[model samples]
Each structure stands twice: as structure tokens, then as C-alpha cells.
Target chain A: MTTSPIADALRLPAGPVDLTAIETDAKPGFDGKKADGKGALFAMGDELADLQERLWAQRTVGSERRVLLVLQGMDTSGKGGVLRHTIGLVDPQGVRITSFKAPTDEERAHDFLWRIDKGLPPAGYIGVFDRSHYEDVLIARVHDLAEPAEIHRRYGAINDFEARLADSGVAIIKCMLHVGADEQKSRLAARLDNPDKHWKYNPGDLDERASWPAYREAYEIALERTNTDVAPWYVVPADKKWFRNLAVAQLLLDTLRELDPQWPVADFDVEAEKKRLAEESPVQ
Target chain B: MTTSPIADALRLPAGPVDLTAIETDAKPGFDGKKADGKGALFAMGDELADLQERLWAQRTVGSERRVLLVLQGMDTSGKGGVLRHTIGLVDPQGVRITSFKAPTDEERAHDFLWRIDKGLPPAGYIGVFDRSHYEDVLIARVHDLAEPAEIHRRYGAINDFEARLADSGVAIIKCMLHVGADEQKSRLAARLDNPDKHWKYNPGDLDERASWPAYREAYEIALERTNTDVAPWYVVPADKKWFRNLAVAQLLLDTLRELDPQWPVADFDVEAEKKRLAEESPVQ
Candidate 1:
């Protein structure tokens, strides 16, 4: 597993995680400007594609290995952008992406992880969660949706759940797209200006924006508590959309390379199949 | 919808559909060579991306309208390739792809369309079925997996099912990727030759290849029986991978243009929300 400097720089350190200390607009490890970042992301496509296919091919041999990307962020932090730019590099057939929304009555009835379990990638898939179980703590804490005791307990429950997933060969990459309040204001205004983007805007977003400080505190607490070895969080500086995409793409490529999934060898005799095809099934 | 000459030429006409009569390698309705074909398919990307977004946005307003592309082809006919090259053009978020393998015990216990119902795309999404319910007729007829009486009944059942989907706002584009015998042999041989592709090879594919005549006859019968006014089948010549991808992309583009999903209007007062963001939510 080759090391990536960006992954190291962005990976949350063990102890308290402060969102204010992280530079939201700075490109920490990437050197070039926007065009170069775009080119770099696109360049990673081939290797990323190859690794994804290899991982997908593991299913043919009944291997249970897979990768899951959990994306958590405030609205307008470009979680959707990462999905389009980063995860889009690979074949969609090999991908299983689930964007979690507000819970339905059926979902709210069960433990939070119940719906999460249903969305997990089967063997050999690269699964992505747009907003994940982390929301149970972030939003639940910020809005006091759940009891204080329940919300506190969810942090440990999430770590245990992710640990079990890792034991079963699911490599989890958790990203917190950390955008500043000022950057988010501009993004929301832009969404309002463009009719094409209005569908993405929710009036309720203003209510959330009003609670930025609370959300930040909620996020810091969630990150510090749930940052486990099995699924550590990476706080991405997301004020620059291009850099955010590039950083996430690099993170995905690094994880896939570390997994180093091999193309499965033929289970049957190759030579015999070749001869049989030539002799018996010669196209009529 | 803009007229696509390819769609006109490929659309299975009313009457008996004969797979043998179509030229597998011909690039009908395309004026250019291979490089031009690739360029054209890539150029379609921007428009495809925009149309997909608009279709996806429709869900914000509770629109059930969506598009479903059904790909039915023999092994090595490039169903996976179409998924990678053609369907891969849109954001994977809006596209729900289901590659139907053999039914599980539960799936087998129910009627064939039962599983298909579970795979339908929700509001504001584009769904692709790598292989779909057509298999119930094609594979069922080829191997006599079902009784002749049951196989005959399935054709009508399929048409009824599709008509119901169309009524519920599914714009269906069913494509039958048509590859010839020599082409199939070469493709299967190529799979055998590449060690990296060994995982894709199955000895059972050879058994299906041996029954080429049976599968072709089954396909012809199924195509003829299930071709509906609401959901038409287009026989895509699959010997040339580029042309197959180009044709399917054009078919999809044309369908989306016809749907002409408008960007949903903001349900909230935009100016009020903008003011609220600027005033009440001024960056903490």
C-alpha cells in the first residue's frame, strides 16, 4: 500500500477535532491550480477504473470484499459534486450509491443502523453513502431530535457497527466536507440565483444555516467521538469545489490501491475451454 | 423530440422480427468513421448530463415520470460495455441500474415479473436493466425452462406489464443488442485469451453459444410478441462496440429530449429565502 500525503494530511488525528482550526479554503496537499487539479483527478480515472473492476471481479469468485465511502457534510459542501466528479470515474455497474434522506415511519421504527444495513454494498461493490449514520448524531444532536442519552449512545454504536463491517472486509472511508459559513452563504445565494439549481435549494436550509455554530459544535463532538480506527474521518477543506473533488478522488484512489484487488484467475481450465470453443461451438 | 435516423432504422417494425436479416456490423444513421463515432458519443455527454439533471429534478415536485432502458443481449454481446460507455454518461446518482442474473429461490417461486417490479426506478431517475424480464421468454424458450404453454403466455404478460409501467410514467427504451455468430465466436475467444478477463468467462456461456440457433429463434419470437407501441424494441447491431454504444446513447438522448423535463420551479419564495439567508443566517 503506497502512502498518499493528502490522505495523511486530511485524516483526523486521534483526540479532539476542531473544525475552526482546519483551513476550509486552503488546498493542503495539492500544489497546482484549478485546471491542474481537474487534470489530476481525470488522470486518476484509469487506475481507479482498473482497481474498481478488479474489486468488482472478486464477486465472480465469491469474495466478500468491498469498499464503502461515507460522505458527511453541511448542505452546499459539494457532497453531490464528489459523487459526480470522484465516484463517477469508475463504472456505475460496480457502484451502489445510496443518498440517505429523512427517515420514513418504517425506518424511524427500527434502530438507525437497520436502514444503513439495507443500503450496504453486496460483495465486490464500491458503495457510497451521501449522508450516513453520522447524521444520526450530527442532526439529531443539533436539533435535539433524539433523547440526549440516546444521541450520546449512538456514537459508540456506530463505531461497533463499522468495526463489524471492517471485519467482514468492508473498507470504510469517512469524509467530512468542512466548508466555512461564508463559503456556504455564497453557495446558497448562487443556488437561489439559478433556476436550474433551485430544485436543490430548500427554504429550511436557511434554518440550518442559522444554526451554523451549533452544527459545527455538533460535528466536532460527533467527529471526536466516532473517529475510530476502523473508520476514521477525514475533514476535507471544501471551500474550493475543484480541490474538494480532487482531494476526495485521491482519497478513493489511495484506498482502492491499498486494497489492491487482483483480477480473479479462471476457475475452469482455460486451455480446455479454448479447445472446446474452437471445436464444438464453432459458429454455425 | 428531435428525429434520430438511427432510432428510425433500428426500431422493430410491426410484424415478425428477424434477427438474421439485420447487419450486425453496419453503422446505420451515422455518417462518420470509428474516431468520429467515439467523438460523437463523447459530445453527447454534456446534453445527456443536462437532460439527466432535469429529469432528476422532477422528483422535487413529486413527478413519477422516469426513463427505463432495457438491454437484452446474448453473452459477450456487450451488455456490460453499453453500461460502461453509454449509460455511464449520466450522473450515477440519477441512474438506477439492475443487471438481472438468474433468479434466486425466492425469485423463482414467484412469477418472473415479480422481481422486475422490485427493480423499477423511482420518480425522477433513469433506470437501466442490463438484462430484464425479456429473459423469461428468451431463456425460458431456449432451454424449455417453462412449458410451451407458459412461455406463450409470458409474451402477453410482458406486454401488459410494460404498458402498465408506461402508464405510470415510465418512458421505456428496450434495446436488443444483436450480434452475429462469427462476432460472438471472436468475442468469446478474446475473453479466453485475456487472463485479466478470465473472471468474465463462464463455461456455461459456451453451452449457451452452442444453442445459438435456439436463442436467436427465441429472441425473434420474444421481440415480435412483446414489441409494444408504448415501449418499442430497438435491435442494436452489436458487432461494432462503438456503433452499439452510439446508437443506444442517441436512443436515450432522443427519449430524454422527448420527455423534456423542466427544471422544477422553487416551491419557496426565492427572494424571501435569499433575504433570510443574508439577514437571519449571516455567517456565525
Candidate 2:
């Protein structure tokens, strides 16, 4: 309902989308310096932490508002980085994070949303999907993993699913980190070049990267079809890691500020209860 | 396996057991002071944290060692406290916690372990189950929720399941926080007498307490049948909250130390990687 400059600039276009037309190097937020951006992120991170605490406490005495942050991106676009930074700012008890991977045989037997439903945050908690149901269209489409008719049905399924969640008081935030082919290549190469980072660089990623043009087309259509007012998508320019982090953080901070949850009032008589506790013997 | 003095003292006896015979105030590893117990717990907590870090990092490179810490106890027995204190010492990214509550309609339709198997910690993670399969014997038996024959069948099934996990490289540490009726009454009353603690105090807990004798008998039987060389049960004297936390932390720290996972050796050519990385454009 309210606008922030970063949100306005980064939200996907209303009409048809062309991935090639967007600049992947833009920084809509802080002046372009890693130190300044990092500094600003942590500072905003503290505010996010305080708001998160209030959100958690409010739920303890029965407030119903919750948040679901869905992250989608190509390999090396830093979905893990966003989760580590953003969730690191909140209490682990108050946040539920599920990093969806290749579906299991059991998961495949059911509808795509079965596991997603299980991972939804209980009231007043922040739920994050590191990669989400959007993958059905992204990779599944790129690899011909599903029928074209099925993939088409899934886009509508996702919209209806998100609409149902919104009706039940979930505030949805979805982001796609827009990294360039060259940027992803350099990141993967950096992983190869650092022994400590080796585990993170999967050889399979290069296989996925080989199909970048097809994946990009799938993403364009997916975004155009699924970007609803209820759960719109934001395309974050991620060639600069710091700017990407900043934009995502700003989006969360603004969205949470609008929710403005408060701690619940105590329901019992404070004085009488304190006296009763004093009368009970201490631990033996 | 090497033994810690605390483990030797607290590990459940091999045969039939009486809950009443055990002292609820023993601090086997600590001097008789809250400060001393708290200090020693934290000292061991740091050691656990370091070992957990190595185990997590090692798995990223490739190590099969993983830990499953299953905590079983009645209400107000400090399972949540143990989770908060012990797991608070480890990286959240490396620990997978599943706090099992009552089974849902879907969960009840399958075998009891169906959901438990789904939640088993992946390789390289420490999995903590707040309540576990043992509940089938404990609550199900006491409340007449299942047939005696079904409960009898479940014990062998549980042992088989644990053996499978052991064969797959999972180290199991199961503990029962042995709090006396007096201690539970005091804790429940403490909740009732504090306005801030009211949410934790369910009035139905009193109804459960009315069946205390039956529950105790059920727990004694459950512990007897499930305690094995592969996955032994430790009955913690949990009337003293500090001692309970210290004993659980000491168990985890000692178990992890024995596993002794280390950072994996890198598999790539370091010198060549450094040279090739120098040729790529630096992150701008």
C-alpha cells in the first residue's frame, strides 16, 4: 500500500518482460561502495531484528500476522547469502527456513505444494523458502522435466496457492536475484579458486548454466504470468552482491514496518500472581 | 567408546527401573552451586560448539558422521530448556530441530515413525527431537490410546529402526529428563503464578497429572525396552534445572568429541586455481 524508491524501481514491469532490457548492474540504494553498503545493511539489520522480536512476542499471546519470504535465482545468484544475512538478523526460534531441493519420491507422489504447506511458518513467525515452488516452472520448464500443459497449470496453481495464503494473513515477499551470465561464471570460478569455498561450487551448476537462455525465457513468462498484486515479484540486480543484499533488506524492513506488530498484554493479575509465586517453595 | 564420569553416572540401568529410587538433586559433574554448574556447562558448551563446527564443515567437503539427539520427558521436564542452552551453542545452520507435538490427521494415518523418518537429520547435521517415537509407548500406553499388543510390537520396531540409523552412520543420544511429581507441580504452579508464564501453563496439564502414576509406569517400561548398546538412554535428575542442562550438554560434548570430525582436505589443485583466478576479472 506504501511505496519505497527501491520497491518502485525494482518491481517487475506490468506488461511483457524482456530479461535483456534490464540493467543487471544498477544500484538503486546506497552509494556504490561495499563498506558503505555493508555498514548500512547491518544497521538496518538491527532494526529488522527488533521488529522481528516484537513479531515473535506478539504471537506468544496470540497475534495472527506472519511473513513468508520466497527467494528465487540462478546458480550463484546468492539466495543462500540473502538467507544467511536476513535470517541471521532474527531469533532462530521465531523463524522457519526450508531450502527446497530436488523433490523426494514421497514428495513427487503428492501435489507440489504438499511440502510447502508443511513448511509454512506458524502464526507470527517469519518463514523463508531458499528456493521455492517457482522452481517447478524454472528448472522443470528449462529441462523439459514436465509436460508443457502441466507447467502451464502450475503457474496458475502457484498464484491460487499464494492467494489462499494471503487470505489467511500471510504477507508474501518474493524476490529473484538478477545476476548476469558473466557474473555467475566469475562466482563459480571464484569457488573453484578457493579451496574453502569448493563445496559450494557444484559441477552440476555449469550444466544448468549451459541452458541459461532457455531458463531466462522460462523466467520471463513465469514472472509475467505469476506477478499478481497480492504476491508480486521483485527482480533484484545482483551483479553487485552488496546492492542486492541492500535492496532485499530494504524491502523486508519496509514491509515489516508496515505490519507494525506489538507485544501482547499480560492476561492475569500481576500482583496476586507475584504474591502466590513468593509463597511457593523455591526449587528443591 | 570412551566414557565421561557424568555419562557413567546418568546412563539408565540395564534392567527394570524404579523412577522413585533415583535422586532428583544429584549434580554428578558439578560442585553444589548454581554458578559452578552454570559455568561448567558453558565451558563444555563451547567445546561442543567447536566440534559441531568441524562436523558441519567436514560434511560440506564429505564426512558421513551425523548426530541425532532425541530428548524425551514429561511436560515441564526442561526439554525446551535443554534445546535452548545446548543447541544455542552450535551454529543454527548445522543443527536441525524437530519439536514433535500431537500427530495431525494426516500424520496419524500412517505408521508413527513416518513423520519421524521424514524429520531424521540429514548427514552432517545434529538432529534434536523434542519428543520422539518413545511417546507411542509412554502416552499411548498410559491413556489406553493403543492396544497392549501394538505397544509390544512397537518396541522391537523402534530397536530395528535405531539399528538402521546406526548402520547408516548416525550416532544416537537419547535422554529422559527425570523430574519428580513434586518438581513438576512446583513448575506448573510457578507458571500459574506468573502472568508472563501463563501461555506455557495449559490447564489440561493438570488433567494429565491426574494420570501421573500410569504415566510413570509407562515411562519405566519404555526406557527399559528402548535402552540399548547402540542408543542408550540417560535419565537426567531434572528437578535441578541447572544440573539437567549441564548433564545434557556434557553428554553431547562428550559424544561429539568421540566422533572427532575434522575439516576436510581440499580436493582441487590449489596452485593452479590461484593462478587461474588471477586471470579472471576481479569482482567490481
* Candidate whose DockQ is highest: 1
Pairs in steric clash, model 2: none
Q: Assign candidate 2 its CAPRI class.
A: incorrect
Determine which window of 10 residues in candidate 1 chain B has minimal summed lDDT: B275-284
User: Local distance difference test, per candidate?
Assistant: 0.91, 0.81
Model 2's DockQ score: 0.16
TM-score of each candidate structure, all chains considered together? 0.99, 0.75
lDDT tens per residue, model 2, B1-284: 78788888888879998887888777765555889888888787567766876787778766778999999888999997787666656666677888788889999999988999998988888999989998988899988778999999999999999999999889999999988877888887787765546666665666677777888899888889989999999999998998998888888887898898875665656566545545544332
Separate DockQ for every predicted complex: 0.80, 0.16
Per-model interface RMSD values are 1.2, 5.4
